[model samples]
Structures are given as structure tokens and as C-alpha cells.
Target: MAEYMRLRQICLVAPQLAPVIADISAIMGLDVCYRDGNVAKYGLENALLPVDTILLEVVAPFQPGPGTAAGRFIEKTGGRGGYMAIFACEDPDARGAKANAMGVRTANVITHAPYHGVQLHPRDCRAAFIEFNHTDGSDDILGPYPPAGPDWQKSIRKDTTLSLTEVEMQSPEPEGLAAHWGRIIGIPADGPVVKLPNNTFRFVKGDSEIMSGLTFKVVDKAKVLEAAKARGCAVKGDEFLLSGVTFKLTA
Candidate 1:
């Protein structure tokens, strides 16, 4: 099995980027790290924010048109939710081969100089899309993650939000879905959680298979929740629903 070095990034989608981006910036007290120019080629727009070493991204379609994957994703998942989970690994080719052998569809391959990324089709895994990337010869966990754009780490701001502590994947059959994802990612599904070096991928019960929520280690959970409420998000217990996903804060 190819070793996954760390949790590099999490991609979420919104119906529209404006409101969601504003809400995330205000509630999390984080700024946009980079608006990747490459996304426009995919008929989408994106904004990434670095919280500690992890990249939190929100993607939206550039225009409402048929056949665009982002548009279809919104309709499939019923508008705005977690879309993709990316990890940095020591060897992407070996890991990708493992998934390919397991009957996972290879969606796309991206390469730019020293960085190489492989994207797997979401349907094959029965959850969200999974991506494995590697920067040639880079071993430092805190080092460059190319998908978030160069200099993403330089944009790290830690006032309210810190690290992405957990990713919550919801499905009616969580155990089965977890096993599928575990096999695809080369991580063992131990109960409902797949443990990574920097974060945990948690599978929980829901109506369907989707990435439903994210848990962040925050500097001030109450204050963050309060900010979320002030920004017109409906507060529920320790979480606030935004962009069709629940953002849970923990101190």
C-alpha cells in the first residue's frame, strides 16, 4: 500500500460563490489564500483558504450550463456540500494503480512541473471524489501542496479557525461506504473512522452518501458560532449550517 503523508485539502461546493465565500471568511476569520486561475478551464471558480497547514476550498460553477461537473454535483447532492477530499502522498502512481485495479474509474490526471495529481470518479467510490497528489521529492508534511496554488502556506491565518480536525461523510450504509473509501484510499476502515496523520475521515449515518459536514479545531468555538449566526446561518447546537454543509466548531 502506498503511504499517505497527510491530509492536504478539502473541497466544498456552493450554489453561488459570493454568499458562501463571504460567510466563510466572516465566520472563520480567514482570508482567501488564492483564487486558482486553473479552475476556469473546468467551468468553475474557486477560493482557497489555509487554516494551519490544511487548505479549505469552496468551488462554484462559473456559469449555469449543462454537462459541467460542478453543476451536476450540486444537483446530485442537492446543492452545496463537501465535494472532494485530497491527500498528499509519497507516491501517487502506486496508489492510483491500486484504486484502478479495484475498478475505480480514473477521472483526471494533472501535472505541473514537480506536482502530479490523480482524481478518482466519485461514483466508483460511492461518496465524494478522492484525489491523491504528490510534489516530487517533497517529504515535509508542512511543505508545498500544489493543488492549493503556490504560496498557500504564506496565507495561513489562525485567529478563529485552526486545523480541519475531522471530515464527516454521511451515508445510510456508513460501514459499507467506509470500506469502499478505505480500499480506494489505502486506509483501513477502523469502525466509522479512517485515521490520517493530520485529520480523521468519519463516516456517519445520513439519508445518502455525501460529505455532510466538517469539524474544525477552533480557537473560540462559541465566538465562531456566534459569528455564524450573526451572518444569518441557522445555529444548531454546536454547528451552523452553511453552503449545504454543517460547519462544526470545537475548542
Candidate 2:
């Protein structure tokens, strides 16, 4: 089995992409890295933001077609909150095979083309697009998954203060979801909090069986909430307003 790196990114979808991107930037203090042109096939556009090298991507559908599955994902999840959680892997193929061994099928495999990526079904992950990917020959993880084009580093801008940091997950069956993800990623699923070298995955159960709402680690969780509140975003405990997406703050 191949060892993996820290958590890489989390993807969010919006009915429209630009506003959400703006919202995340204004609210979270993150810088937009670039938008990937390849997403045009799925009738979608995307922007990548760096939170300590953990990519935060916001995507919106521009048109529905063969390549973009954003439409189907939106329809299935009734819009948005947290769409996908992507992680770094030393060997995507090896990890992909591990997932397959556990009865989880790969949804797609993106290779050499730039980055090597493999996605597992959400059902297997309990409602999330779990991707394990690595860029060939370089530990410069962010550069491989180009936000705009295949020029490699053109899309990645490192933020020394920003760390991929932490991820919070809300699921109806927290333990079950964690365990399921553990099998998929070869990580232990024993607690509410699963910590990695550069990040953490925290799980909490809610009323519905579906997973929802996520919190990303920021420099100041309180400041993020205050900023959002001032901008007319509703704040309830750790989460803020819903505009097809829910942003939460957790330490």
C-alpha cells in the first residue's frame, strides 16, 4: 500500500460559481488560485483557493453535458454544502486498488495528463466524492491539479501561512461514515476526530442520514463568522447562511 500525504482539498458546488467564489474569498480570507478550463466539458467552471495549500474549490455548472457531473451531483444532494473531499496519495493506482478491494468502484481516473486522480463512489464514502490523487515526480502537490490549464505550476500559488489544515464532516452516522472513509483511505476511523500531519477530519452526526455542512480550519474561526455576519450572512453557532451552500466554523 502506498502512503498518502495530508488532506488536499474539499470541493463545493453552487448554482452559480462566481458569487460563491467571491463569498468564500471575502468570508474566509483565501486567495483565488485559478479556474480550471477543463471543467468546461461538464458545463461547469471552478476556482481554487489556497488555505495553507489545502485547495478549496468552488464549482458551478455553466451547461450540462457528458463530462460535467456537477448537474447530477446537485440534483442528488439537493444543491450544496460539501460536495467532495480530496486527499493526497503517494500512489493513486495503489490506493484505487485498495478501494476496489473493498467493493468501492472508481468513478474516474485522471493521469499523466497532469495529475493522477482516482475517484470513488459517494455511496461507498457515505455521500462524498472521495478522490485520491498525486502529481507525478514532484512533491509539489498543488501544482499538478491545474485550476486553469495543464501548465502545471501556473495555477498554484503557495501561501506560507495557509495550510490545508482541517476538515469537519457532519453525517447522520458519524462513526459509520468515518469507518467507511477509513477503509477507503487506509486511515483509522476510531474517533470523532481523525488527525493527519497537516490536517484533520472531524465527524459529527445529525438528524438526517445524509452528510452535510463542513468547517475548514482558518486562522481565526471567530473572525470568519464575524465577517460573514457583517456581510448579511446568518450565523448560527458555527455555521453561516445558506445560499445553496453552508459554511461552518470550528476550532
- By lDDT, the best candidate is 1
Q: Write the per-residue lDDT of candidate 1 for residues 50-169, one digit (tens) a residue.
A: 888888899989787455788899887787468899888878777889999999988999998589999989899777889888887557766766667777777788878887899899
Over 99-152, each residue of candidate 2 has an lDDT whose tens digit, in order, gives 899999898877645577898887776667888887665466545554433443
Candidate 2 Cα errors over 4 Å, as ranges: 64-68, 140-164, 209-211, 217-223, 242-246
Q: Residue 183 in candidate 2 has what lDDT?
A: 74
- Go through the candidates in order and give each one's C-alpha lDDT: 0.85, 0.69
- Steric clash pairs (candidate 1): none
**Candidate 1 lDDT:** 0.85
Q: In model 1, where is the ten-residue run with the lowest total lDDT?
A: 137-146
User: For model 1, what is the alpha-carbon lDDT of residue 50?
Assistant: 87
